[model samples]
Target: MPFIIGTPIPDNKILVQSVSHIYGIGLSKSKMLCQRAGFGDDSRGLNVTPHKSKFLENLMDKSNLLLGADLRRFQNDKIRKLYTIMTYRGLRHKKGLPVRGQRTHTNAKKRAHFNTNVS
Candidate 1:
């Protein structure tokens, strides 16, 4: 059987890489998770035993790291707060412009195009 984390199993990937399929988990974190789960770095996803998978699931549950829907919800909430506060970043988000002060005149063509398309 395939191991399911935040989503469907990535049976074709190496176990270290496969764990990164979970939202919010990056390559470094995935490697850390493999170590903590007592799985070797070279382990393949299909070779993950039920016990190891369960151990991983439990570790994720106990960790502060958010995955999948929870991470999305947290980000959405943060953006909502920014929007509600009417900060500069919020205004940029509302206007569909770059928020980090990237030069909009030359850069952010995609965002500019998106704004124009909406009208």
Candidate 2:
């Protein structure tokens, strides 16, 4: 059986890489999660017994880390806040341009391109 985290089921393979499939869990965090769950980095997800899998599930539930839909909602809320504030970044996002001060002269031509088609 596959290990389900949030909406995704991780395939039975390297434990660290499997865990990293969930949102907000990077390589380092996945490694730490594997260590915390008493599994070796190379341990296969399929090899995890029900008891160990339950423990891991509980650990994930208790952690502050966001996953799947929750992570998406959180990010959307952040962007919404930025838009509401009308800050410089918000303006850039509103305009569909690069928010981080990238040169718009040439590199951001894709973003700067306007739809020429008229109804």
Candidate 3:
């Protein structure tokens, strides 16, 4: 395993896949990063070289991209704001119910009764 942007990825992970271990970068963004870093399909990096790591750090800094703990904190802050605002979704979230308007008539059976004996 190796660390990129403070996230550990499997040693054998593809270059594009390796970059996606960071919280904010998805597959598409990872491909873009690999291309920008000149890491091609053949670059089976055993580990990120110091030069490559430095380049990536600079790129992320220039792009103002948030990763890892920073992204998690941002997401948590947004959810916490919703809770403080008492939004319908926040109430639903607090109740452990579907917050996306999902039908609950046949699904949220917290105390469903079942017959136990054959007549």
Candidate 4:
């Protein structure tokens, strides 16, 4: 396939999967990211330019993708922000109800350690 935007994509079919190789980017979201970055829906894994590669690497690193950011970065950030709001102990203070949302009275067994029976 012709190189997209003058960038040579990697020949590895697996690497071009968008979501599998990238952190903070899921299959769907990866498509969006590629779209945003002007990378069309081509199955080719463009070898990011040196500058682009550095930019992406740095971006991923700063975004807390130490292990990976493909899709978890978004979730990680959300959970982290919630925990910060409750001072890391808000979960316990609020009876294990997720500070973000979720019905506590019926579907919160994992967090209810004070006096709840899982069975």
Candidate 5:
């Protein structure tokens, strides 16, 4: 398994999928990264040689994309900011409920179950 940005790439997965295991990267972005790194569709994670991996890493570094833990931290900070401002979405997050206008009339029972904070 190759480690990229402190995340492990599953050797059994196809290269693009394995790359997508990294946070903030999805299927399309992973495919683009692989294409940029000169990897083909059939490439597996195990085929990521040190040089190729380095090239991939360099590509990620050079790109202005926010990724991995930094991306996660940035999102969390945004949520935290919303919470400080007491926004509706922040309240929903604090209540452990769906924040995107999801109706809690019925399907949100599971979320309600975890919402121990009453009022």
Candidate 6:
């Protein structure tokens, strides 16, 4: 393949290390996105090709996955929407809790207290 200058290659490492390059993407979520994108969990960033880069960008756009350049836009939108819906429901959404019909009894982070002052 001809060397494409300036384009990045997406593989396991990049997915794991710096997938935040995409909009709405973060470390934990990026791993899941990469998994769903079929790049495996341990892929490297340098291995990504121009085609993969295009695929990733398209995938992120289509699925609301975060990537390069416009991440803050999504963050701001999410924050704004969260505030607009502010209520127990809005707080739930902001905290990433189960909103629709998921059980939280098994894992309630908010219910549990983390006291740094105890130290």
Q: Write the per-residue lDDT of candidate 1 for residues 51-80, one digit (tens) a residue.
A: 888898888888887788889999989998
TM-score for each prediction? Answer: 0.85, 0.78, 0.79, 0.34, 0.89, 0.43
Task: List model 3 lDDT by residue over 2-115, tens digit each.
Answer: 566787766676777777778898989888777788788656557577788778767777778778789899988887788789999776665666778888799865522332
Candidate 1 lDDT score relative to the true structure: 0.81
Highest-scoring model, lDDT: 5
The parts of candidate 2 lying over 4 Å away from their true place are 1-3, 111-119
Sort order, lDDT high to low: 5, 1, 2, 3, 6, 4
Model 4, 44-66: lDDT tens digits are 54445556555544444454543
Shift of residue 61 alpha carbon in model 2, Å: 2.8
Q: What is the Cα-based TM-score of model 5? A: 0.89
Backbone clashes in model 4: 13
RMSD, candidate 6, Å: 8.7
Report residue 104 deviation for candidate 6 (angstroms).
36
Model 3 misses residue 13 by how many Å? 1.6
Report lDDT (Cα) of residue 118, candidate 5: 41
Which scores greater on lDDT, model 1 or model 5? 5
- What ranges in model 4 sit over 4 Å off? 1-10, 14-16, 55-119
Judging by lDDT, tell me the better candidate of 1 and 6: 1
The Cα local distance difference test for each model comes to 0.81, 0.76, 0.73, 0.50, 0.89, 0.57
Provide the lDDT at 34 for model 5.
Answer: 98
Judged by TM-score, which candidate is best? 5
